[model samples]
Every structure is written in structure tokens, then in C-alpha cells.
Target: MGSAVNDFAGEFDKQRFQTVDDACKLVLKHFYMAKVDLKAAYRSVRISKKLPFRSKLAPGIFHKLSQAVRRMMSRRGFTIVAYLDDFFICERTKKRCAQALAVLIALLRKLGFCISWSKVTDPCQKIVFLGVEIDSTTLETRLPISKLTDLKSELAEFLLRKHASKKQLQSLAGKLNWASAVVRGGRVFLRRIINGIMRLKQDWHKLRMPGEILQDIKWWHDFMSTFNGKSFFLAKVPITSVVTDACKSGAGGFYHSDWFYVNWVEDYPFATQLHINELEVFSVALAVKRWAQNWRGKRIIVYCDKAATVSCMIQ
Candidate 1:
């Protein structure tokens, strides 16, 4: 009767009813089988005064939602209707269902509520909500592929928006520089795409640190120079790295990454995860552990995803 989009929408996410099966089952055991649907679902109701931001189309959506509720409620035989779009107090008996539905229709009409039978589900079988399929006998909700498709689009939009502003793109650049070796290698090229952010702050520029930039450029050139042959040899050099860290949550952890010197000669350069803090200790322990009469000349590089972590180790 009253048009209010907010009345229905805010509760859309309230898991007050987790799924169709859960809701139906609760009513069945505690109540009854009378069911009704509002026609025009979303357009059946008008926007409430408190939530009248988009009034142009709110009425249509409210009407639709109301129609759906009315259709189902009117036919379910519920004498009383709580929501024009939602049927209330379903009973356990078929006769009760009809009586209840009738009373509800009379109340609505008396209250100047309009009925649109075309929108209601014929007493035929069932309904579905949040992907669950339901009926008088049982309710089965399935994972909706459409929802995932919608989510994918949402994620894409989020990424676009998240990277749209200067601050956002700067954060993204920071994340990418640390997360991707390839991006780190091509930092200069990637800078152009990210740096054109609108309204960028002067002092807060998203530029790579000078020392880091030099290291990245040198590393990139070095790797590219011998990517095919002797670089492979360099990569195969046996490496032993240690990683350690302390967490604010009162947790400490350490890790070791190793590779045979001979395997470094493979086409792919060797790679391993190392915590910058732990690697320093590992370097000392490994050298001491391997202390022998013969000195094995070997070269290896320790890579850490976090620049701060790497700096902490050196300090």
C-alpha cells in the first residue's frame, strides 16, 4: 500500500533468511502452506519519504514488488497480509491457507490496495530466492552462475575505479612493483601508465626509490644479457637462503630456500622465496655450516617481496 523502496531493499541483504529452504522449512514446521507472490516485484512499491533519493523510478519498482507479493498472498488464502509483496503467517492446513489468503485480499482491497493476479504464482508449485529452488515438497538452492558473472564485472569495475585516481594508482603501482618481478624489471615503462593520475600530489609522487630503481635496472639488464647461456649457469649456482620474521601478533617464523649449484645452469634462472630478515642469518649460518677445508666459490642473490623487509635485514 505504501511505496517505499528502502523498506524492501535494506533488508535484501539481511540474512534474516539464509536461504529459501531455511525460510520455507521454518514456516512449514511452525506455521503453514499458504503462499502468495507480489506482482511486478521490484516496481510494486514507491520510494519511502526517508529514502527518496531516486524518486523518478522508485514508484515503478515499489509497484512491481507489491504486485508480486499481492499475487502470491491473494491466492495463498491468507486472510491477513503483512507485506504487499510478502505473504505472512502461512498455516499448516490447505483450508487455512485459503481462508488466510482471502482475508488478506479483503484487507488489501479495503485499504485501497490493488491486486494484479497476472503477477502471482499459480498455486502450481514453488519459488526460489538467493538461488535456492523451492516448492511445497522441498527447497533446493543452487550456486547461481549469473551471480558470479555479475561479480566478475563488479571486480573489473572496482579495479578500474580503484586505479582511476592518482592516490589509487600510486598504491597500485607500489603493490605491483613489489608483487611482480616482471613489472619491477619494466618499472620505467609501467610508470608512464600509472603516473598520469589526475590531481597527483607533488611531494607524494609515486616514484620508485632511487636505490631500488638502480638495482632493478641493473638486475633486469644482467638477467637479459645472459638469459640464454651462461646466465643459466649463474642461475644454477647452488644457493642457500634463510628467512625469518617477527609478527606484531606475537609470532615468529623462519624459512630456508635452497638450490643446487649445478641446477643453476638450467634455462630458467633459479628462484626462491626468502624473508629479507631471515636471509641474513641464513647466510651466516649456511657459511658456517658449510665450513670445510675446501672453499666453494659460488654466487647467489636473495630476493624479497617487501623492500622494507629487505632494509630491515641490512640494518
Candidate 2:
């Protein structure tokens, strides 16, 4: 059973989805894989009849239910990773996968949770979970074609409009940032759009685009045209931390006792309008580009004072 704090209060105790990096590691080690789905997981939870539909106790009830299911599955020797209703089972052999699936399905039915047979795919060499396609044989992960198509469609529809509100601009930027999780150096593409929106005053509707913004829109189209569903390989790499700082006019970084600086060139279009947050992000990007050859296939941990900049880079 989950504690009261887990059920009712802060998110510190909540279970989060596993990161793609870690999941890919498992796929590389385990050649055989299976996926299980619990139909309407939250809706199927058997709460007390007395609890009202909109009761505050709903989350606590659900937490208890999830905890119970996790405990039951763990004790059965079927080690698995989960995100809400989806469970991923990885094994070294087909026999182990079959055994785990049988145990998992039997346990789910005994617990009274309906299983989605349609979504329960069989063991395969390649499988997709949480929008990421994992190829066990090659030890690689890539965004599925379906997700890429949807993202491209959304951006196309967004650019078609003659005028866009601040809300729409933010939505479009959010979509691009979401894709950055899988796409390396992806957030840089949205710098123009984000800066444009930030420059807007109180007037959020009927936003105007400057010449640079228009140029960026064209650049984005060309960029997407060249995209061929980029794929990333799974590798364990050593991480080097880079600390960066910036002011209105310049930015610098400290890495391995070496310091570097970049003076904001007024002639550059980006430098003139770059906000402090953008400067901080630019500093990190600059550092990465400068050292990428040496750090190829290695993780670079960037520490910046600006929270917004850090968040933007991660997205």
C-alpha cells in the first residue's frame, strides 16, 4: 500500500516513466521482448463504492492500486518496467518471455484488471514503447514514423495560417521541444520562433512576423525536408560537466579548468535580439559545437545559472 503522502500530496513520490536511454540499455542486453497492456488501467481500478467519482481520495486510491499491482508482479519473478498501464518485459530467451507473459496475464486477470488483447503484442526482435522504436539486434532507438508524421503535420498546419496568436506560437514551439527529447540539438531550430513570441507585447493576437522570423520559417521548411527520420544508437558514455554563464553582451564557459568567451557581435542578427536566457543557451550550444569532435558519443553535462535556459536545452 502507498503512504498517504504518495496518494495525496507532492509529486516527489510519484513513479515516472523510465528514460529512453536506460530502456535502450535493457533492449540491447535482452534480445527477446514482449509488451503488455492493462485496458483502462485507471478506470478499471476497484475503489470503494462509497467514494464519489470526483472525490479527493481518487488519486490515493489509484496509487494504492498501482502499488498493489507492482508488488504482485515483482513477487512473481517477472521483472518488468512500466509506465502507467504499459508494461515492458525483456528476456534473454523466448521461453523466458513466454513464461513471464503467462504469469503476468494470469496475475492481471486474478487482480480483476481487464487486459487489452489487441494491444498486447507478441515477443519480437523490434518493438515500440512510449513512441520510441527499439531494435534489440542493432541496439538502437528511433522515433516511430507515426509520431514523426504527426509532428510534421502539426507544424505544416501551424505555418499555413497568415497570422498566429501567441498561444498558437507557444503550442508550435512546445511540439518542437517535445521532439527534442529524441532529436539531438533540436531546440536550436525553435530559437527564432521563441524569440519572436517573447518580443511580443501585451497584444497576443494577430502577432506580426519580422523579416528574420520569415527567414526562419523558410529555414524550418528546408530543414524538415532534409530530415530522414534520424536514428540514435545506444551506448554508455562518460559525461563531462560544462558550467556556463552569460550577460547581455557576452557569454562564457568553464570546462576542465579551461575558460572560453564569446563577445556578442552586433552585426549578427541573433546577437542583437538575444535575450539573457537565449545567451545562456547559446553559450552551452557554442561549447558543444566547439568540443563535439572530441566528445563524440560522450554525454556532456551543462550547468547554467539560468533555469529557463537549462529547461530549454533539455526539451
What's the residue-level lDDT of 97 in candidate 1?
59
In candidate 1, position 42 carries an lDDT of 42
| Per-model root-mean-square deviation over C-alphas | 19.5, 7.7
Q: Residue 271 in candidate 2 has what lDDT?
A: 75
Leading candidate by TM-score: 2
Q: Model 2, range 5-117, lDDT digits (tens) per residue?
A: 22443344445444455555666554788888888887676566766555545655565665566677789876677666777777788888888888888888888888999
Clashes of 2: 0
Best by lDDT: 2
Q: Name the lDDT of candidate 1.
A: 0.40
Model 1 misplaced regions, further than 4 Å: 1-22, 29-84, 129-132, 142-148, 156-315
lDDT of 1 by residue, 229-252 (tens): 110011223544533333222212
The 10-residue segment of model 2 with minimum total lDDT is 2-11
lDDT at 84, model 2: 62
Q: After superposition, how far is residue 155 of candidate 2 from its true place, in Å?
A: 1.6
Give each model's whole-structure lDDT.
Answer: 0.40, 0.70
Q: How many clashes show up per model?
A: 55, 0
